[model samples]
Target chain A: MPLPSSIAALTAALSKLPGIGPRSAERIALHLVQSESGAVSQLADAIVAARVKVHLCTTCGALTEISPCEICASPRRDASLVCVVERPVDILSVDKGGTFHGKFHVLGGKISPLDGVEPEDLRIAELEARLQAEPIQELIIALGTDVEGDATSYYLAKRLARAGLKITRIAHGLPAGTGLEFADELTLSRALEGRRELS
Target chain B: MPLPSSIAALTAALSKLPGIGPRSAERIALHLVQSESGAVSQLADAIVAARVKVHLCTTCGALTEISPCEICASPRRDASLVCVVERPVDILSVDKGGTFHGKFHVLGGKISPLDGVEPEDLRIAELEARLQAEPIQELIIALGTDVEGDATSYYLAKRLARAGLKITRIAHGLPAGTGLEFADELTLSRALEGRRELS
Candidate 1:
C-alpha cells in the first residue's frame, strides 16, 4: 500500500534537496515520522528559522544574518583585494584554506548560455558598483575552471579593463594533495606555464 | 569562522537524520536557507505534519495515520498468518516481495543486551496479546541475520511456542540476483541445507 499523505508529502519535500533521491527521501521521512515528536518539531522549527533569519549580505551577497556580514563589515580585512566567487557556499570553500584575508564578492551565478544565465542575471552590476565605491586595488576571480567560468572571467576582464583595475584569476594546477602522475594534461600544462622562481 | 546561529541549528538538526553526515547536513541547510521562503516553509510544514499525524498502529505497531493501520484493519488479508519484523520500515521490505498476503507485527527493535534493549522493551507483549485475541495460526519471524536478531528470534520462538502455534523463520540463501560464486560460505551451506524437492 502507498504511504499516508503526510508521509508522502514529507518524502516529496525531502527529495527536492540536493543529494537526496526518492528512496533516501522515503527513508528519512519514515525515520522522522517514527521519531519523537519533540525532535521532529525542533528540526522543522530550525529549518524555518534558518530560512527566515538568514539572508544575503547587501555588501557582498554572502549569506548572513546581518546586512554587511562579518567579513564585509570588518576593517581588518584587506578591502583593496576582493575575491569574486560564483555562490555564497564558495566563500566557505575559500575560507577553509585560511590563507586569504581579503574581502569577497559573490557573483550569484556564472554566465551559462546553455542554462539561459547571462551577465545581467548575475551580480555583475553590483560588482561594478563595488569597484567604483570601494578603493579596490586588485580583483581576484576565484571561479570554476570550466567553460562557463572561463567565459565569465573573460567577459568580466574585458568589461572592467577600461577602468584600469588589476584583474587576476586563481591559478589552475594539480591540487595540493595529488601527485603529478594523477594530474590531468590540462592541469599539468597550466602548472608548467605558471611555474614560479625559487624563493 | 563558524556558521551563523540559524544555519548551524539547521545543520545540527539535519545531521541528526539517518545517513546524513555533517557535510551533507551543512549542504542541505545552506540550500534551504538560500531557497525561496515559500518552498522552505512547505518542507518545514511537511515535516511537522508527518510527525504529528503519523503514529503507530495499536494492534500491529506499524506506522499509520489511523489507530489499527490499513493492514490490521483490512479483512482481505490472511488473518491466520502474521509476519513479524524488527522495525516498521521492515514492513516495506516484505511488502516489496508482493507474495506475502498476511498482516505484520512490528517488534520496534531486536533484543540487544549490550544496548540495554530487552524482550520487554519490544512489542512482544503486544504480539502475545494479538495471538490470544486474533485467529493467528502461524508466527513468521522475519528478523535480521545478525546475532541480536538470532537471539530475539530464539527467545520469541521459545516463549510463544507454548501457545501451540506454528513458528517459522524466513529461509536464508543466496540472494536472487547473485550467483553461488558471490555467495559466502555460510550462505552456500544454508542454501544447500534448505534445498527443496521439486514435484
Candidate 2:
C-alpha cells in the first residue's frame, strides 16, 4: 500500500545522517538506483569493512585498524611533543597542514558542563596516564576557541603545568588570508595578544 | 606514515557521495568507528544487500528488490491513468502525498538538447510501447519547472496527445504557505493564470 518498501527504507536510512534532510535523502536514494551498479555495493562493503576492522588506537584514541594506529607505530614522530586535539577529525586537519612532526592525542570531546560533558566524560584520564607513562616534555593544546574548548584548554593547562610539564596552548587568531575588517573583535584581540616579532 | 590504509581508503570513498566533501567524509568515517558500532554494520550490510538485489521496475521504473515493483504489480492502482515523471524520486514524493491512485512512468531524464539529452536518451520508447499494450486513458506530466523539464513536457505533449486520450500537465503556481510578495514574478503570474473559480 505504501511506496516500494526498499526505496522507503533507503530514504529513511539516508535521512539519519547529519545535514541530510528528507529531500536530499530522497535525491541520494534515487540516485543510488541509477548510479554505477557497483559503486553503491562498494560503498556498502567499505562501510562494513571499516566498521568491523577499525578501532580506536589504545594510546591516542584515534581511529585505526590496528591497536596502536600508524602514527603511534611510526618511529620518526617526536613522542615527547604531543599535540592534544578534541576529536579524531582534528588530528587529520593538523596532519594535513604537514607542519607538525610531533604525535597526536584525541580527547574525544571538550569540557561542556552545559551539554552534560565533563573532564571525566572525555579522555582526560587517558591523557594523564599517557603523560605519566611516556617521557613527554611539551603538551600542545590544539582545541577550538569555543566555550567548551576554552574551558577544556584551561583545565588541561592548569593540570599539566602543576605536573611539571611544559603546556602550551596553540595560538588563536584570525586565520591567514582573512581581512582585518572582516575579523571579529575577539579574533582581532587574540591576534594582537598572540603577536610575536618576526625574526 | 598515515592512518590505516583501509580507514583512509574508506574516507576517500565516502567523499565521492553527493554533498560530502573531504572533511565531512573524514568525520563520517571516524564517527562510524567511535559511535554506533552495531548500526554502522547494519547500514553497511543494508547498502550492499539493497545494491545487489535492487533493480528498476520494467513497468514503472521505480527501484525495487523485485521486478515490476509493488505499485506496478498492484491491481488496485488505476493502470489507465499513468503519471509521467522525470525521476524515481518524484514517484515517491507524489506517493507520500497520498493524492494519486494511478500508476507511474519514469522518463529517467528530460529533453535537454543543449545538454545533449534527447527524447531517445530517456525511456520515451518504453512509454510509447506501454501506450500500445495497455488501455491508457489519461497521461499526466509532473516534472520540474526547469528549462529541460519544460522542453521535455512540450515534446511529449506533441507526441503523445492522441485522438482519444487526454494528456495534461500538472498546474504550476506559488507553493502553499508562501506569500505573494516573496514569490518570484514568473511563479506568481503562473499561479494567477492557473487560478480556478470557487464554485
Candidate 3:
C-alpha cells in the first residue's frame, strides 16, 4: 500500500537531500512519524532556524550566520596565507582537518569546460577584489586532481599573480594511511613529480 | 574549526537518525544550509506536517493519518485471517510484500527474557480482544528466525490456541535470490528441514 500523503511528502523531501536515497528516505520518514512530537518539532525547528540564520560569508563565501564568518573575523587565523577551494563545503573539510591555520576563499565551482563553467562563472573576481583590499601573501590552491580543478587552479594562479605574492597547489599523492599499491598511475606520477627533499 | 552553532545543532540532530553518521550529518547540514531558502522551508514544512498529521492506528497500531489505518479499514483485504508482528513498522514491510491478504495484529515487541520483556509487556491482550470480536480463522506469525522470535511465536501459539483457531509461523530458510554457499549453517539447516515436495 502507498504511504499516507503526509508521510510520502516527508519521504519525498528527505530523498532530495545529498546522500539520502528513496529507501532511506522512507525509513527516516517512518521513524520520524513514530518519534516523539517534541523531537520531530526540534528537527523541523533546526532546519528552519538554520535556513533563516545562515548564509554565505560575504567576505569569503563560507557558510556562516554572520557576514564575515568566524575564520575571516578571527585574529589568530593567518590572514596572509589564504586557501582557495572549489566549493563552500570544502572550507569545512580543510578547517576541520586541524592543520590549516589560514583563512579560506570559496570559488563556488571549478571551470568545467565540458559543463560550460567558465572563469567568469566562478568567484575569481571576488578573490581579486579581496586581494586588492587584504594582506594575503600566498594563495594555496586546494582543488583536487581533476582536469577542471587543475585548469581552474592554474587560471587563478596566473590571473591573480602579483609582486611578492606566491601561489601553490596542494600535493597529489597516495592518500595518508593508504598504501602505494592502490594509488592510481596519474596520482603516482604527480606524487613522484611533486616529491620534496627531506631536510 | 567547529561548525557555526546553528549548523552544528542541525548536524547533531540529524546524526541521531537510524543510519546517518556524524560525517554524513555534517555533510547534510552543510548542504541544507547552502540550499535555497524555499527548498529548505519545504523540507521543514514536510517534517512538521507529517508530525502533525500522522498517528498510530487505534486498532492495529500501524502508523496512519486516521485511527483505524488504511489496511484495518480496507474492505478488499481478508479480515478472517490475521498476521502478527513485533512492531508497527513491520506491518508496513509485510503489507508492502504484496501477499498474505489478511488483517494484522502488532505484538509491540517480542518476548525477550534477557531484556525483561514478558507477555504482559506486549499488546497480547489487545490481540486476544480482537480475536474475540473478529472472525480470525488463522494467526500468521511473521516474526524473524531469532531465538526470541521463535520463543515468542511458540508462546503465542500455545496461549492463543482454541478449538477452531490455527496459529502458524512464517518459514525460515536461505532468503530468496541468495545462494546456499553464502547461507549460514543454521539457515541452511532450517531450509533443509522445511523443504517441500513439489508435485
Candidate 4:
C-alpha cells in the first residue's frame, strides 16, 4: 500500500520547500512520523513561529523580528555607507564575514528584462528615499556580475548619480582560496583588469 | 546583524530533518519566511496533523492511520503469506512494486550484534504471535544483503523452522536493466549459484 494519506500530505507539503524533491520529501516524512513526538511538534511550532514573527526591516528591508532591525538601529554600524543586494538572504551572506559594518538595502531583485522584471518592480524607490533621509555617502552594490546584475547596477549608478553620493559595484574576480585553473575565462580577465600595483 | 532569533530557531529545527544540512536549512527557512502566509501556516498544520494522526499498526508495526491498517483489513490481500521488512518505511518500498499482495511485518531493525541490536530487541515476538494466530504458510524476508541482513535472515530461518512452514529471502543479483558488468563479485556468485535450467 502507499503511505498513509496523512504521511503523503506531509510529504507533499515538505516537497514545497526549497531544495527538497519528491524522494527526499518521502524520506523525511517517513522519518518524522516515526521520530519522537516532541521533536516533530517542536519543528511544527518553529515553522509557525518564524513565519508569524519575522518581518522585513522598514528602513533596510532586511529580515528581522523588529521594524527597524538590529543593523538599522545600531549606532555602531556605518550609517553613511549602505551595501545594496539583490535578495534579502544576501544580507546574511555578506554579514557572515563580519567585516562590513555598513547598513544594507535589499533591491528585491536585479533588472531582468528577459524575465519581465524592471527597475520599478524592485525596491529602488525605497532606496532613493533612504538615501535622501539618511546621511548615506556611499552605495556598495553587492550583486552578481551576470547580465541582469550588470544592467541593474549601470542603471542605478546613472539614475542615483548626484554630487556627493558615490556608487560602486562589488569586484568581479577569481574567488579567494581557489586555484587559477578553477577560474573561468571571464573571471580571469576581470581579475587581470582589476589588478592594482602595491606601492 | 545575524538572522532574527525566530528565523534562527526555524533554521535549527529544519537542520534536524534528514537530508537537510545547515546551508539548505537556512535557505529553506528564508524561503518559507518569505512565502505566502497561508502556505506557511498550511505546511505547519500538515506536519502536526500527520504526526498526530498517523501511527504504527499494532499488529505489524507498520505506519498507518488506523489500528489494523488498510492492508490488514482488506479481504483481497493474500492472508496466507507475509513479507518481513527491516523498518516501517521498507514496507512502502516493497509494496510500491504492487506485486506483493501479502501482508507485512516491520522488524523495527535488523539483528546487528555490533550495534547491540539483538533479536530480542526487534519485533520478533510479535511476528511469532502472528504466525501462531494466523494461517500463514510462507514468510518472505525482504531485507538488505549486508552482513547484518544475512545473519538475521539465517537466524530467523533456523529459529522459525517448523513443519508445513516455508521461510525464504528475496533474490540477490544484478538489478533489473543493469548490465552484467555492474554486478559485484558477491552478487555475481549468488546469481551464478542460483541459476536454473530453462527448458
Q: Against the unseen true structure, what C-alpha lDDT does each candidate score?
A: 0.93, 0.83, 0.90, 0.92
Give me the displacement of residue B83 in model 1, in angstroms. Answer: 0.8
Best TM-score among the predictions, by candidate number: 1
- Span of 10 residues, lowest total lDDT, candidate 1 chain A: A156-165
True contacts kept of each: 0.88, 0.49, 0.77, 0.85
Which has the higher DockQ value, candidate number 1 or candidate number 3? 1
lDDT of 2 by residue, B38-81 (tens): 78866776565556667878887877777778888889999899
Residue-by-residue lDDT tens digits, candidate 1, A1-199: 5688899999999999999999999999999998888999999999999999999999899999988899998998999999999999999999888999999999999999899998999999999999999999899999999899999999999987746679999998889898999988988999999888999
* Residue pairs that clash (backbone atoms under 3 angstroms), model 3: none
Give candidate 1's iRMS in Å, 1 decimal.
0.8
Instruction: Show model 4 residue runs off by greater than 4 Å.
Output: A113-116, A177-189, B179-182
Runs off by more than 4 Å, candidate 3: none
| lDDT tens readout by residue for model 4, B68-179 | 9888888999989999999888888898898889999989898998999999999999999999999999999988899999999999999988898899999887789998
- State the lDDT of candidate 4 residue by residue for A1-199, as single tens digits: 8688999999999998989999999999998988899999999999989998998888888999998899999999999999999988899899999999999999989999889998899999999999899999999999989888889999999999988999988888889999999999999999999998999
Residue A160 CA error for candidate 4 (Å)?
1.3
Candidate 4 chain B worst ten-residue window by lDDT = B171-180
Candidates 1 and 2 compared by lDDT, better number: 1
Better of 2 and 4 by TM-score: 4
TM-score of each: 0.95, 0.79, 0.94, 0.93
- For model 2 chain B, give the 10-residue run with minimal summed lDDT: B44-53
Docking class of 4: high
Candidates ranked, most accurate by lDDT first: 1, 4, 3, 2
Docking quality tier of candidate 2?
acceptable
For A48-158, candidate 2 gives per-residue lDDT tens digits of 787778777899988777878888888889989999999877887899899998888999899888889878888988888988888789999999998888989999888
